[model samples]
Target: MVADQFGLRAIPTVYFLQQGQPIDGFQGPQSEKFIREILTHILQTAEELKIAQATELMATGKTAEALPLLKEAHQLEPKNSDISLTYAEALITLNQLDESQKILNTIAIQDQDSRYQGLLAQIELQKKAADTPEIKQLQETFAQQPENAELAVQLALKLHEVNRNEEALEILLTFLKKDLSAGDGSVKKTMMDILSALGSSDPLTNRYRHQIYSILY
Candidate 1:
């Protein structure tokens, strides 16, 4: 069967097959380092073959096998966003939402401001609407990371949703004062948004408004 893959028209003259197998085959999983150091060259050559095979598998609805092959290709070349995206899709199709989300999250965090990460964050936010375990876990983690402006902003938004305006305002202001300087004005805009959300056109809003005006003017 393997010989047929090489387009061998007839029996080989003085055939010397390894264990009656024409193709060199691996029996079991190998270490990541071994695959990276030695098999990378071989994997690069095999990628086109793997993609062809995986496409056939997917066409035949054998997505389970196709997913692993795609994932393997991704491991071989992590920069291949298409492979990573396809693997994430396959995982979703297989009802592996957690794994898919985790992969997307890693991709997003590693490549800040990527469209992939933005999509992942949107998906996470949608899922978080029901107050899932993931959302709760993220909130807990964000609370521990006092220096993370993004997380603070996210948590502040969540707090505002529950009408915890005071807490949200405090968190947002602290984030602005500590991380985002007055010169940047992003934190001031955030403060205005939070104040508007809370229906507070008070002295604080005027102060932030003045700050925003100063930054722009």
Candidate 2:
């Protein structure tokens, strides 16, 4: 009736129907740019809503539930690195290292950002004590990426595992002198562990020997 009254031959219409009632409609297909602008606005609104819900869940100590929502939002927008990284972090907080490592590994491969690379290094180090070829392979894989404080520490720890304290000392000392806050405190803690493992009697150990002595004594 409206189209006939407007003397339109053909009218394109968009309808938002709710329970068979037309709640909203657009008269015609908009231009590509206008449609894209509308879609972008809708997507941003959805992302914000999901982020707010996830944050609420996390605050309420329902991280388990929050994780899946965050994962969905991330899947909806894989280009959002923060969402991906936050999902990995939430998984870590939930003590799901395997899942977290999987996400982190993807980011490390795609982004190769220092933060993601450092995380992969830390995860590998956690598995360093395993007496298997896999641990060695993991270390070698990480060595190919850009070096960070944590990577340096993990490489040092791997070197020490092969009974090369001098090289490990170099890595640990180098990490200690840098701004490693982006990589968490794992680098510093690993340095301590390496110093303890190296023992005070080793010549390369002299640099941190006093600090080690204070800690153990």
Candidate 3:
């Protein structure tokens, strides 16, 4: 039955399922850690779907509607970093900065994940948007020298400061596409920083991450 239902071709096939739907599986024996990771991933995926739905609602200016979804997702996967970040973002959108910061502070300092750092940066930028003069200066420089990679990185960071994340990502992506073979990894690193800020489950992040992987491998 397992072979027929799951297309198992080997003797030691295993399947992981949730609500009767197959999430992941292996065709051979695996380490305990590997199996644990797969199980964790399955749980994470369930929460990710809720976050995606919440994001779509937010994109339509339905922040109030998105909140319940995010809260439910967070509750379902309390240990998931990505879901927690998205939940905090939704709180930010609702002008609940104190609540947002509390969530951000809970994330461990040693994690050092780009997404976590990016969210922290976002909160800071939102708190001091009026006090940042560098943003204006970078904008002017980027306007004058659109092809300068360094300026582009600086400008994109400024744009992200103002929550113009899509524009920021586009700027980095354009530069990376043109300088794919450049010895310096600055462009790629900048792209990853933006992607990590955008969150791992974001479609744009996934798309560009795949593009980078294709180029490197």
Query: What residue runs in model 1 are displaced by over 4 Å at the alpha carbon?
Result: 1-44, 108-217
lDDT of 2 by residue, 21-74 (tens): 655445666788876765564444665678779989898888877876887887
Residue 199, model 3, lDDT: 71
For residues 1-217, what per-residue lDDT tens digits would candidate 1 score against the true structure? 8545655555332222456654332334556775565455444455566766777888888877787677677677666565666666665555445556656755534554455665566556544554645447757987688777767667667765644444556666665555456325555566678778534323234555555455456
For each candidate in turn, give its C-alpha RMSD to the true structure in angstroms. Answer: 16.7, 17.4, 17.0
TM-score of each: 0.33, 0.37, 0.40
Write candidate 3's Cα lDDT for 67-151 as tens digits: 7788788888777777788888887775455557777776665754897777778777776763358877887778898878878
Q: Candidate 1: TM-score?
A: 0.33
Residue 100, model 1: Cα distance from true site in angstroms: 1.3
Task: Write down the worst ten-residue block by lDDT for model 2.
Answer: 126-135
For each candidate, the alpha-carbon lDDT, in order, equals 0.59, 0.63, 0.74
Candidate rank order under TM-score: 3, 2, 1
Task: Please report the candidate that would top lDDT against the real structure.
Answer: 3
Ranking by lDDT: 3, 2, 1
lDDT measured at residue 119 in model 3 versus the true structure, 0 to 100: 70
The 10 consecutive residues of candidate 1 with the worst lDDT sum are 8-17
Higher-TM-score candidate among 2 and 3?
3
